[model samples]
Target: MTIADSPARYGALSRFFHWAIAALLVWQFGGICSEAILGEDHPLAARLSANHTQVGTILFVLIVCRVVWAILNRGRRPDHGPGLLGYAARLGHFSLYALMLAVPTAALLRAWGNERAFAPFGFPIFAPRSPDQVVQTATAIGSNFHGEMAWIMGVLILGHVAMAILHQVAWRDGTLKRMT
Candidate 1:
């Protein structure tokens, strides 16, 4: 109920950011996975893909906000604890944050460098580049790495969930409770 995080547990805003981002990421992945598995023309896949760009844009904005909020609440949040397990936990979290930012950024860069206008949510984000002015480097990096990095991020997310479950069930620790 509190607005700011405490040593014992995350505050309302942090929890909101955490859960909202999780849900949005799930949605984004679902869209891509559906298209990858079912083919783009399939009804379900098509429906999900229809909103992919718009949803990604919204998710990207939310991520930036969440990172800023996390920085603002750094020391007040729950601790990872001492020794090796703690170090692993910290590293895992850092990886997650890095990918969360990187995946969308690469995609956005591609959009920006593409020949077509980049309009997510019907708002013009990037104007179409003229043929001679296209940024091949941005396009190439985005095209080459976005999907690969996303899959890596997906694996990391699964590991993150597994660890949370381990903490809640095996360790019988209050770690999962800190966010929940």
Candidate 2:
């Protein structure tokens, strides 16, 4: 498969990024759902929670790369098309990207300002902040909005999937084909 995007379809790299990120998101949400349903003390929830931060860090890195790649391929990528639907599509994608970045970033900021060290995959990214030295503003922002923003993002993602299915089955448009 080609590595760069073209007018008709997404290239291999783009598809890789898309699917990989999608899978990671599924994992992330699965963990959240398990914890919510089974309670935090459940074995499945414990298993998933063990790696949540590390997985989130990896996801954040992948997102940054994906955004950079999208920018690089902007002109070469498939067109969004004309009219109201297209505008809505563009706006929707923008919102997704923004939340994708914001969610992890807020988490990271919280970690940074936390009393304990911030390490993902056993690698330290931020050292511990003493109780007195903690950045309360960063901590508060992250604590206050991370979960709320994530739920909003979850809703948007469901809508995104619904729209994709609609385009494929009802509209009979090649929109799904462009990515798949």
Candidate 3:
């Protein structure tokens, strides 16, 4: 069941998902940044890539939980910001959810398409098909779209962070407080 009223504060599950996602994003950003600076051949780059994959898998699961939670608790309003700002916030959030779902789904398809073994915890989610047609098609589509989406996500995320900083520093708004 979901709460229809405005939340007094984020519930325990909401808070956990929010903070967990935040931490994972931080780790992801760090890994991405390090990879850009250190080059792909560096030891740190390899480690970061492994870390990125593991954390991304966790993010995929967390996002699924978050979406389910959000669907169930549809009526609870978040703390309000300025009118235009609120619209932007909503847009940003929607974009975030779209990218979160799309990116991972694409990556999974790409992996499966290549007939690559996905041994997350030593369990295979999909069995190998002798002729992997769906995976092959998905991998081609996913590679192109995923790169484009990644760029879009990066811009939106930067904007989101900028807005949060603006709220905290310039406006002294409580926008960041709700999530923080």
Winner on lDDT between 2 and 3 is 2
Clashes of 3: 1
Residues 1-180 of candidate 1: C-alpha lDDT, one tens digit per residue = 898999999999989989998998898889889999999899999988788888888888988988999899999989999999999999999999999899999999898898989988779989999999899999998999899999999999999999999999999999998898
- Indicate which candidate wins on TM-score: 2
Order of the predicted models by lDDT, top scorer first: 1, 2, 3
**Predictions in order: lDDT:** 0.92, 0.91, 0.75
Select the stronger candidate by TM-score from 2 and 3. Answer: 2
Regions of candidate 3 where Cα sits further than 4 Å from its true position: 1-5, 79-82, 129-134
Q: Model 2 off-target regions past 4 Å?
A: none
Q: Which stretches of candidate 1 lie over 4 Å from their true place?
A: none
Candidate 2, lDDT over the whole model: 0.91
RMSD of each: 0.9, 0.9, 3.0
Q: What is the lDDT of residue 6 in candidate 2?
A: 91
* Residue pairs with clashing backbones, model 2: none
